[model samples]
Target chain A: MITAERKPLDEILSYIKPFKRILLLGCNECVTVCAAGGRKEVGVLASGIQMSMLKNGASIEIREHTLERQCDPEYVEELVPIIDSADAVLSMACGCGVQQLATRFKDKPVFPAVNTKFMGGSDRHGVWTERCQGCGDCLLGVTGGICPIAKCAKQLMNGPCGGSVSGVCEIGDEVECAWHLIWERLKALGLTDQYLEIMPAKDWRAGGGSGPRKIVREDLAE
Target chain B: MKTQSNLEKVLSGGHLAVTSECGPPRGASAQTVVDKAKYLEGVVDAVNITDNQTAVVRMSSLAGSVLVKQQGMNPLLQMVTRDRNRLAMQADILGAYALGIDTMLCLSGDHTKFGDHAMAANVHDIDSIQLIQMVKGMRDEGKFQGGAEIKGVVPKMYIGAAANPFADPFELRVMRLAKKIAAGADFIQTQCIFNIEKFEKWMEGVRKMGLHEKCYILAGITPMKSVGAAKYMKNRVPGMDVPQELVDRMSGVAKEDQPAEGIKICLETMERLKEVEGVAGFHIMAIDWEEKVEEIVKQAGLYPRPQV
Candidate 1:
């Protein structure tokens, strides 16, 4: 899931301060589950902004709305009617959703109310941890379902660097050494031989090293 | 003669080679490297020029190696995967070789979090093992990592890699060393040896696999300057196994005598490691205390380093 956190109240306040009216938009996707850019968060932000503005002896109009998905054009079209009533649109979604709003409402300014963090999932109640980097290709099959590219600090392919100590990374105690996890998993599965093999240099071309990537699903294309 | 590096010649000549580390200054000071090179000039076969060790920005290892080489000492250029991608790494290898650096140590350097630049992005395009293979390919096959032909003058380097016997999943450490050797690492320099018992066990595994015959294995030694240094490494430093006994020994001495006690412990470890099977040489990392290296080397009976 694409996780995010709301931008600071001050930064969001600064953006909407220039406009008399703005739409506070939220997403029902990953941000919702993470308690970041859901409908409730939109209501909370709307009230905060209104109160902050009223304390300054001025009040601005705010329209609150939450989309089923902000990154999709079909769902973004639902804002076509209400978007014109506001001076600008402040999106509380990931970068994809923010960009989608920007592209859809070219005339009205679109400000992001939240900061897009990473493509991760909720670790526990309110905590989220990154799981994937979407590095076009995946090596999870060979790595016992662990992703070194996303987890390891050095992104090493061969094995753990010398920094792996007691299943922890040198960077911090909280961070688990990805290679250590791989070794343990492989050992448990009687696949220690796989851990011995050297993974070659990664081809970063697929991971956007070449440039922005695109895919055309020929089977689903008209 | 693979690049005719002095370190290579010493190891190949069945002589216990001596190599020490010299970290480049954070600022651009060629004289600093020259000064450090003086202490290690006749004391060791090669001096390893660290590349932004601990992630702190410093004068590049290539330039430092050149400076050390100019001072009439062989420089072992250390390259880390944390800073540059394959293009920069390959380009720097060619550049370093052109500037007369023949020995290279490949490492996945300390993460940036440990360095001054914690916010910096790390570029690990190739791990240390692959870096070893790449350098060997450039030297032996005259090809780039991507298998393209080098138009002319491929870099010929005596490739080296690092090993840590104290790191966890101890059973796999020997296998990692084997993989490094198979990847074309001509020599292996281990992490600093504070826990000789663990290291000897690791060497036992190395001997079991007969990996000692495949590559030169240099035991890494660092002389602790104080009891604080020992305790810090024991508790804070990653993969360091500083036994409680060593810390107690250091603290038992007066503060003024701690430095000498530290050297004594280093000499004792080197003396013991010299008798261990599969141990090829000693890599003295006198970290900032380079002046102490000569005394350590001479007292260990490794003085008058073999002229290969």
Candidate 2:
């Protein structure tokens, strides 16, 4: 799932400081799973902002709303009634959701309350680790399911780039070397011979190189 | 011949070549680089100019290589993918070649977190292998990375890449070397060698795969300055394999004599490595101790580098 983290309280406070009436929006999707922009977080942020403003002797009316998913236009229309009443709309969703909200509610200023991190999942209850790079091409079949593009520091096709020390990446001890993990997985599956095969240079046009990518399905089009 | 570089002439002629490294100064002074090059002038075949080695910002390697060239010594310009994108890298390659640099070492330099600029974003548009292929493409095919044809003569350089035999998943190190060779790396210089036994094992794998026949393999040697240096490399430096016995030996010596003892140990390793098959030469990374390179080369019987 797409992961995100809450922006600093000071930065978020600055965005809403100019507005007398504000709407704190949250998404019930990836941000919620990551404990970043969920319904509970919206309530917590609303109270925190109110407390911060109360200390300054500035009285401001703040409202809270949570959408099923802010990326869809249908779900975004749910905010039509109260959208114009608020001076500004603060979205505690990923960048995509914030952009979608801004596009739909063209008049009101929309600010992103969270920073979208990467496409990853929670490693533990509160910890999240990156799993994929969305490189368009996936090589998990030969790599034993570990994504070197996302995990390896160099994003080496044929790696463990002379910096792998004792199953850890040179970047840090906490991070496991992607190729080391791949080698161990391949060995366990008795596919160690495949480790010698050289992975050719990637066609990065399909990855993050060409430009912003778009996929359209003619079959699903109206 | 792949360029008219002195290092290439020596290696291709089947002579045991010798190279040394010279880290560019942190400040804007070419005097430090020139002085270091003097010590290695007639002592080695080529001098590698490190590019902001360890990610600490320093004088550019291209400018340093030019200084070495001015001193009548061959400079193997080191290029790292950490700081430059493909366009900058390609332009630098052309600039280095135009400045008469004939040898190039491609690396995915040390991470920025290890240097003064910990928050700087790294622009690894290409890894070391792809960088080597890119250089080869420009030299052999006269084309840019995007496949645009060059208008005139392309930069002809002797391509080089680095290998670390001490890193984990040891069995795959040789295969990685093969990948670099297949990517058009004309030669390979390994990380500092302290564990001779481990390096010999890696060499055995290289011999089995016939990699030495494909490209020249120059083992890296760095003489430890003191027991603290040994311990630091063992514990702190990533991918370094400083054996405990060497540290114990250094610890047994007086503080003042540790440098000499370290050189003696390096001399002994070079003598033993001379007999190892597939050992093409030695790359002495004297670090800040460049003055000792001449003495080390002489004592190791590598002085009077064969005139090509």
Best by TM-score: 1
DockQ for all models: 0.84, 0.60
Query: Distance from true position, residue B19, model 2, in Å?
Result: 0.4
The root-mean-square deviation over C-alpha atoms between each candidate and the true structure, in angstroms, is 1.0, 1.6
TM-score of chain B of 1: 0.99
Clashes of 1: 0
Q: Model 1: per-residue lDDT, tens digit, A165-214?
A: 88998889789999899988898888988876878888889999999998
lDDT for B155 (candidate 2): 95
Q: How much TM-score does chain B earn in each model? A: 0.99, 0.99
The segments of candidate 2 whose C-alpha lies over 4 angstroms from its true place after superposition are none
Clashes of each: 0, 0
Computed on alpha carbons, the lDDT of every model, listed in order, comes to 0.92, 0.91
Which 10 consecutive residues of model 1 chain A have the lowest summed lDDT? A115-124
